[model samples]
Target: MSTVIKIENLGKQYRLGQIGTGTVSHDLNRWWAKIRGKEDPFLKIGEANDRTTKGNSEYVWALKNIDFTVNQGDVLGIIGRNGAGKSTLLKILSRTTLPTIGSLKVKGRIASLLEVGTGFHPELSGRDNIFQNGALLGMTKKEITKKFDEIVDFSGVERYIDTPVKRYSSGMYVRLAFAVAAHLESEILIVDEVLAVGDAEFQKKCLGKMKDVSNKEGRTVLFVSHNMGAIKNLCTKGLLLENGETKIYGEIDDVINQYFKKSDAAEGYFTSAKLDKSEVVFIRSIRLSNQTGRATEIFNTGDDLIVDLELESDEDISKPNIAVGIKSKNGFITIGNTMLDGNQMPDLKKGLNKLSITFRSIPLLPQEYFLGIGMRSYDCKTFLMTTKEIGYFNISTRMVDLGITKPMAEEIAMDSVSPFIPYEWDFGNGNIQSFNILNNVIK
Candidate 1:
């Protein structure tokens, strides 16, 4: 397949605090330089886009020396942290903004859904907006008419097709916007995180449509999202940007793995003071330990996860709601626990406190998992402290526990078995009956 889009040395620069020259004289100097076929003086002093650092220059590069190519019918996923220049790159690709440097080559009509209601005129009716977007994508009236019904039906807004979009809710606007962009017959499609505003069902529909567009219609796509699952599912290739610079570009799985390695959980330990902030109650430290009681980031199936929590408080907190949430490396919240729920929660005294939470024979399949801890008032109205993805541990596949009667590889999950819970089964009335299947394992 041919390259549908190519960017070489692509760069975009912006002023830090002021817009369009601090003074008229400077603006004239820039115009004179532009007219004389000379480089703009401001370009020489632009700083790199490292958000963590303070720089002296008034200009910063939103994107610098970005080079990549997207093949025809390829779906490329772009990912990065906030202010990492993801939106800026998309804006440049969508022609909504001009890059201060470098060249961008395009091979087809590009339809972009960068933001909610990006191409729509709010005063116009949904029906009119659909036709307008189609027209902008170079579709003739006849061609747009042919797809009009499909677009309206897909948007699930047929009842309000003639209603002015100004009154549409954000979700409705996203649905209509996505439907038009997907059906407008554009050869290339670009979608930003704006799709996240849509409901789960609508997002599923949009993903399916993008798949159809790429596979059935042979169109190219550029998808930008923070949802690693979505990116892994929809994209065949990936591009990772940090500080407005391309860090990795290749197959999606490798790219996602690289992403996991860069995440906070990958550190296996979160020690920063940012984890807790409440004076009523605060966590002093949180860490993970394996069965041997030694701090370990790697775990085998059927190993105990010992979570040690040390906390402090300025005032006595009675019956504080304490919990720990375990999330998979893929960002799935696998299991969460509270102070045994509906039971007598121990009163937390002022000053230092210590506790250990243990998950016997961790049942999660071979993968990485992170921790999210929280504490709140007994009434659940005030949060003392809460943290997410504070630390992570890895689970490697291991043989079944030494005494297990039967074990299946596929049975592994957040809860494969409960050794701590006691239960009784009775064959009553020729039917099996259970007593307290979820009876307390930890007491």
Candidate 2:
């Protein structure tokens, strides 16, 4: 297949502090020099983006020396933790932004769904917006007319087709917007995490549509999702981006494995120190270990997962609701086990409590996963006290799994041992009655 997208040592840099100052003048000068057929100005090469003691006088390198290529009919999965420059890379690919150090080459029309309601005009009716987007995508009015009803039906917003998009709910807007982009028949489709906001069933349908768009239509797709399951099911290749560089680029399975390993090594899960807390309670810390109580970050499928949690209680409370959630490296929340989901446990004592959650065998596949811890008053209807993305770990092994919940299963043996030699039994009604005698000497 032909290459549809190509990046050569792509790098994007942002200055520290604020934009628009003497820097604007310098950028203008560079633009004028380029227009005048003079050598580039900023190509003089200054310090890098590191401000450590005696370090390069710098701002920040949002992306650095990134290079990758996508072929036609390929569904490429992009995976990374937050602030991993995934969105920055997408912006560059979609031409929404420019690279500071490198360049990109594209060979076809690109339809991007980087954000919800990306290209829709809020003031326009859903029907009008569809036509407008189609036009922008180079589709003729007759072409859009042929597919108009199909798009409306797939979006499930036929009732609101004539209503202005600004009056539509977020889900409704996304459904219609995605419909227009997906059905417009663009050669290269770039989708980000916008599909997450849709309802479960719609999300499933969107994933299926994306699969069809790539496999059946033979179009190239660049999908960035936090849902590991979707990526595993849809993508044949994967690209792992970290610090604005491609860390691993190969088959989907291997790329996902490397991304998970690196994720487990990240120090903290939250971007801010002031985590989400409430008057009821708060989470102090979360840790993981194995059976022998050794602090291990790497685990195997079916291996025991010991989660230790430390929490603080604001006041004296009884029967506090405690819950632990397990999310895959890509943000697909698989298991959310809560004490409230099961029989009520003992009331949490005062002040502080050390809770130990044990999973006899983690049913997840080999990959990086996160644990989100939450707490609340048992009687309180909602789980008010919660800390998200509290901890991270990695699981790896060569094991075929069935379901998410790996409950213990067993089988019992019966004492009927027979082969060529056989025995016979008789049934009687109060009186001893024999039905057969050695099968009548084999008749």
Candidate 3:
């Protein structure tokens, strides 16, 4: 396969609270350094793009020293948290924005859908915009006409094909814009997180179309999305970015695993120092552990999971309820509430309080899951403290350690969204059998 896109030492810098280097003097200095064949003087002062901390530098590198290559027909998934420079890299590749330093090489015409309504004229009707985008891609009028009907049909906005795109809903814009980018004759396609605006059915359709575009049509694709499942489904390669630098780049599954590891490591433990002091109740610390009471974020199937929380309340609360929820990538899988389970929490005092809950013989299939905790009134009317995702943990079955292929493990993970529960089978021939499949495998 031939290399279609090459990036070496790519970096983008921005001034704090300002645009275009923030002043004419800084711009002039940069130009002077460039003409003298010297590195941009500003590059030396920029800090890494870590949004969690306050930095002393006036400039930050949104993306720094990014290096990668894409071969013909390769689908690359860009994975990162928000503000991790995924969008910045895509903008530079799309030529919508220039990098602060380094080189980029592209071998063919590129089509990009970086955001909603990208490459579309707001005043012009969607019909005209399609022809206009095609013309911009160097397609002749005759060629645009050839693919027009297919694009309209795929977008499912045929009823409003002649409507001004400015009047279209965000979802409608995404549907039409994606249809154009995917159906056009460009050799390379770049899609950002904009697909999230569309409905689930459209998102599925778009993924199918992108898969066919690369696998069957021999075109390269660069995709950015927070949906790990979608990324795993459509991408052949993965790039993990953090603090504006490439953390990992290789096989999609390995990259995704590394991403999850980083997430679980960073969030598995928490302290009250990170919380807001204005809250009525303060959770000082939270931890996850195993049956033996050893702190850990990784667990095997059928392991007893433990949660420990230290909290303080400003005033005595009567009949308080505590809840813990487990969430997968898609959404919440199960919620354990003290009130619902008939285990009422004790009244919170004015000072420190510690709480713990044990979930026995967790039968979760191999996958990563997040934990959220909350405290509310007994009547479930007022919330004292609540956090959607405070920490994360990973569940691994014995098959993963026994050399099962990564894809096979992932397939197992996707097979069910709920934990495996104990069950018995009846043959109806005066025979009955009960088996703990997960426990047997793990034990």
Highest TM-score among the candidates is held by which one? 3
Candidate 1: list runs displaced more than 4 Å.
Answer: 20-23, 29-39, 263-266, 274-324, 327-370, 374-389, 392-443
lDDT of 3 by residue, 1-443 (tens): 99999999999998888665558998899899999999878879989999899999998999998999999999999999899999899889989899989999999999886367667899999999888877776678998899999989998999998899899998988888788788888899998877678886787688889989999999999999876766777899999999999999999977877776654234446555436555677677778888887777778778777777777888888868877777887687766666555555667888887766666677776667888877788788878886546778877453455466554344446545875443332222334344344557854
Model 3 worst lDDT window (10 residues): 423-432
Which numbered prediction scores highest in lDDT against the true structure?
A: 3
TM-score-better candidate, 2 vs 3: 3
Can you write out model 1's per-residue Cα lDDT over 1-443, one digit (the tens) per residue?
89989999999998888665566877888999999999898889887799889999888999999999999999999988788899999999999899988999999799887378777899999999988877776789899899899989999999989999999999999998888788877889998877668776787788888889999999999999876656766799999888888889999876766655444342334463544444466666776777787776767767777777777778787877766767763454434334344433467778877776666666666455678777778887778786555666755443344334232332233223323322122112233222232664456
TM per model?
0.72, 0.66, 0.78
Question: Clashing residue pairs in candidate 1, if any?
Answer: none
Instruction: Write model 2 residue lDDT over 1-443, tens digit each, in one string.
Output: 89988889988876656666788787898899999999766554444332333435335676787888889999999988777788888888888799888889999899886366767898999999899887876778998999999999999999989998999999998888788779977899988988778887787678889989999999999999876656766799999887656789999988867765533344322222326544556666666677677666667666667666666666667766666666653453444344423434355655665666665555555545677766656765766575466667766443234333321110000011111111111111222222222355675
Scored against the true structure, residue 45 in model 2 reaches a CA lDDT of 45
**What is the Cα-based lDDT of residue 27 in candidate 3?**
84
lDDT of model 3, residue 79: 96
Name the better of 1 and 2 by TM-score: 1
Q: When superposed on Cα atoms, how far off is each prediction in RMSD?
A: 8.9, 14.4, 7.8
